[model samples]
Target: MNPFRTQRPARRGGRLLALAAATVAALAPALTAGQAAAAGPAPVPALDVTSYLGTWNQLAAVPAPFNLECARDTQANYTLDPQGNVAVFNRCTTWDGGSNEIRGTARIIDQVSKAQLRVEFPNVPFQEDPAGTPNYIVTALGPDYSWAVVTDPSRLSGFVLSRTPALDDASWDQVRGAIEAAGQSPCVYLTSPTTGGIDTIAPLCTR
Candidate 1:
């Protein structure tokens, strides 16, 4: 069953209303909230993966409920881990003020193009089961492939990844424009909180 459809009736007040709205919204085919009225930025049709293979810093992103438990400095790294699979290194600060880290593998499930691919964590065998929808789309990539945006077709997911935590304001704007073109409402992006972590990241997320 779709997780969005499983709603409890006990909740009341604003929470219930918001859940109802989310369920209705999820069932619809339109892009997630904030996609309409976007203009100017032209959509880039394909991504370049060859140059895309490298470490990318997570700048700002929509806070998905699944990742909510992650610390403000949460970041993911991709490398050709041993065993010939795309290894994923996910690290974050824990709520109890500890470090959170997990290792997983990724593969190109759809093989749409050399540029586009779906990445899955927890390894391939675990993903083969029916309960697997935690996939991400490689939407837009920089010319040098130093930065990229990952979002699903439903527009329910968005991530701004870079080769470094700090990106120039002008280049960031260009990426934001491209995201808008991909039908994502730019208003949902929230800056990653970076304070007293391994990497002191300045809040680079913007509207």
Candidate 2:
């Protein structure tokens, strides 16, 4: 009558062990995702700010609440100020056909690489928080300054900027490669509208 008692206990233990292994397997993907999310992107080896100044069209970006008001045609114009700081003027088209513009200042944080910068937009709420610091790293750039990719250390924000409103197939491919290399998921980015001219609504890029 009690001959199967010991076998029952062994079977139960085996089942418990199997369940634990299954649970770990189920959680493996989530663990890997968390690790990837926490790992920051790598910035370009060097950045020449002198050649980086100019108007750039937004090709794609990881959506941010700060830029939520923008519907399409996002762009940024950079110029060197007399004090050696970079003047920033960002503009994007609103849903109502008007444009939203913000003025900001950018200072170099890494003198050697010149790829890291800190940007501040005065009067902007979260963006202007004095206690918080946001990283601006230039992760990629075109040889002739035709396009650039900007990202943060947190990988929460990213932007694909081009000197022109659009890039050719080859250039776009290069931009995608750079985005991936920067630890960003290209699938997560939404293409910015850049048609009917800058600051106007147009067809969106194919994902």
Candidate 3:
């Protein structure tokens, strides 16, 4: 045998090392994902609440019992209220070819980011969100407030909003990307069938 040649014990040690390396390689992805989860999703920096207040089209949203009547053509119009809160007017087409709407108020909770707010709808029989949970977090937004990804602290309910009823391919991709960045699966967001640009009511991931 050569002077530097290893015996059976050395071969065993080498095999163990190789096995450990393979194990780590297999777990690397999971570890990285865990790190991201630990960090948690956050809102964009210094959002201009004034510029953000306007009409936003509902591109896609997580299915919620409160929105069961909304078959298609969803939109939200926001304006400033004298009490320093935002007034919310959400409208959507019902299956019976009539329009339904609900009015609410959004009070900004996080003064710094200006992306966290609490919305309260008065006299609405539908109540999906838990009581006293005061966060309607805007997790993602585009430049000039072209598009937005809305989610709550729990990351369960979500909404993909746009400035118009329809969006281009790049804008659609950006919306989906924001959803993924917020640690939400696009499959949970079903597209809202508007006038154009992916009018089919299907899961966002299918498109």
Per residue, candidate 2 scores C-alpha lDDT tens digits across 1-207 of 000011122333343335434443554565458547666666678787888988888887765445555666777889999999899888876555666787878888877788888888665544554544447889898979899888887676778888888888788888888877776656555566787433322112334
User: In candidate 3, how many Å is residue 104 off?
Assistant: 0.7
Clashing pairs in model 3? none
Positional deviation of 77 in candidate 2, in angstroms? 0.4
lDDT of 1 by residue, 95-187 (tens): 445565666666554444543344554522424635434366676777577677777645656778777666676878877876766776555
Q: Report the C-alpha displacement of residue 120, candidate 1, in angstroms.
A: 2.7
Per-residue lDDT value at 184 in model 1: 69
Give candidate 3's whole-model lDDT.
0.71
The C-alpha RMSD of each candidate to the native structure, in angstroms, is: 7.7, 17.3, 18.5
Candidate 2 regions exceeding 4 Å error are: 1-39, 127-134, 196-206
Q: Which window of ten consecutive residues has the lowest lDDT sum in model 2?
A: 1-10
Q: Per-model C-alpha lDDT, please? A: 0.54, 0.67, 0.71
Worst 10 residues of 1 by lDDT: 1-10
Expressed as tens digits, the lDDT of each residue in 1-207 for candidate 3 is 001111123343344335434443554565456545755568877779899988998888876546656657788889999998999988877666667777888888788898887887776543456554545788888778898999876665788888988878898888888887877777667777787655666667778
Ranking by lDDT: 3, 2, 1
